[model samples]
Target chain A: MTQITSAHRKLRIILWSGAITAAVLTLGLAAFRMGDDPSHKVTYTGEADIRSQFSLTNHEGQSVTEGDYAGRWQLVFFGFTHCPDICPTTLAYMGTVLDELGPKAENVAPLFVTVDPTRDTVEILKEYVAAFHPRLIGLTGSEAQVAEAAEAFKVYYERFEEESAPAGYLMAHAGHIYLMRPDGRFEAVFLEGNQPADALAEEITIRIAKEMRS
Target chain B: MIRTVLIAATLFATPAFADVTVTAPWARASILASRPGAVYLAINADPADTLLAVSTPIAKAAMIHSVETGEDGIARMSALATLPLAAGAVVTMAPGDMHIMLTDLTEKLLEGETFPLDLTFETGGEVTIDVPILGIASKGPVEATQ
Candidate 1:
């Protein structure tokens, strides 16, 4: 083989270096743009597209829709005042989380929607929610309204009869606390016994930080 | 009521075996006019047994119930006629799971009060437990010494 000339070797090296620089610059710019995109900032694990729309009555006897809670992060739970165990436990946990959040709690709203609206009237909800976190809003409406709300949130609830239960009826419902973004999109869910208040506070704090950054 | 109390006391005095014991029986405080509340406890039985029924004078009726989460993730409670306890098994009736439901309360259960409960077993016979009243937000039974 003939020996290569110095000029020919320099040309080959410059072309290869230029190609490498272009690729690196393109990838860097794309990653920077992705960081600026709000949708790509931080998505919660197990995010789903659950519709958030409903017309219900708040504990204050005021008619409310999802729009009433616009522009704020929301923590929503479905339960009834008549529920003895898990409902109260979750509400207390929410109270503790809010208390731990301190002033940052102002950026979030907690809602308790009654699965059994037949017995949970506005007055009853007002009393029930006040016992928990002062900022918690209790929502209840007619049976049809409550059903529609539960449906929109993908919440499962059914009232069944048990011979030994009061009036032979009790409501069986999912015990999940749903987190929604300020735009009312489903973000994540916390199972009843899985996450404690301190961990919940950390999650909320992280999400709020990501949102603020975005 | 007097006779029921006496029977409960006698039954509690003689446990069928040292291993068969009820621990940390507790109930949630029921609000005004609310007809039903739930009791949670832990039961440890050796040589196996079945929980046939539960009774309490403070309520019109009491029964065992278990909350099941469907594949769709909805939770619902169903009456349990008998709960089989495996040999050397420990069963916990806690929030969001199996529990003893008390209906038609004679009086509202107040926090800091202890009430009597009678549990009938298929093999271990019957035993009485003093269920303490816990706060509505309590997740588990408070220890007796605590």
Candidate 2:
């Protein structure tokens, strides 16, 4: 009993240290790409067994709990509807991967959670995200909700105005793609730059297979 | 509109004043059958002459697309009835602004490779440009242009 208690105390101390470190890393403000190294690439931090339980709304306007995502892989993109180009391109690419994977696509859920929640309401998200890939899901919520979620993910975004929209707009945003596993643990992240479809597919396959074995 | 005229005039010019060049030529390739491949090339059309639509063997249906994304944010791409090249006008075809959408690609457009694209204009005559393929990243900062 004494040994067990000592082990329990050690585990509790480790958990507390981890929580404090994570808090310092997450400043509650929009932060740019977190894992960029000297190579200027999206470095893999391995899958984080994230226990963050978030309740948000899907593009379908349905209440999605963490349980709904319990048994599949997920590719989450933080973007907005106003993104005329990149958003659609990434969705189409991911959709193509899913289609090519076919039955295997069942293991993956392509999710689009808007960092710009104020403009990306459920109704608009439904029509906009659907235009790219039918399998894509959009998520949005209140300002505080979005800020909290973004803080958790370490995403950075700001507003900018082009000559076309001199009246202040959205554009300045740190773009990154986050990959997650079924148990809701963070997997890998793909940063800006070209990624081969076959490579991505292969990588996910490996991760899923490893996860299964684990 | 204004940028092209000034740049086109400064390039190679004949005594009669007719010079043409493609400014930004970007080609988009996709494996999705539902979508068409897009290859955009900007031509500096001489105001003294005009530019007529050319032909493309790469696509089953080819036409200069006049595209616009309206207030609704829905992009509408239509066949440009006519592309007027005032003697000193240069066309700027870019992403989210103006571009060519190639439909029903014959084959895959591999990255770092170039393919032959023919453009027949009224004054500049037939100009075949080698369109290079760019790899489209899944998402993020690097995929900005795609």
Please name the candidate that would achieve the greatest lDDT relative to the true structure.
1
Which digits, one per residue and each the tens of the lDDT, describe model 2 over residues A1-214? 0111111111010001121112222111111221223343344666454332456799888978557878988877777655434454556667666666667777888888786787678988887667557788888888777666666666656555433221224444445567777877787876423344555676678888898899
- lDDT by residue (B1-146, candidate 2, tens digit) is 89898766654343333345454455654433333455655555433445566555766544565545443233444456457766545465544444555554577555666677777666556667666665442222124233
Over B1-146, each residue of candidate 1 has an lDDT whose tens digit, in order, gives 99999967865454443234565567877665464788987675655778788898998888787878776557787888888888656677877777787877889888999898888777667677778887766655332223
**Could you give the CAPRI-style class of model 2?**
incorrect
Residue A52, model 2: Cα distance from true site in angstroms: 6.0
Residue A2, model 2, lDDT? 13
* Best candidate, DockQ: 1
Q: Model 2: residues >4 Å from true position, as ranges?
A: A1-43, A47-53, B1-18, B23-146
**Interface RMSD (Å), each candidate?**
26.1, 22.3
DockQ of 2: 0.02
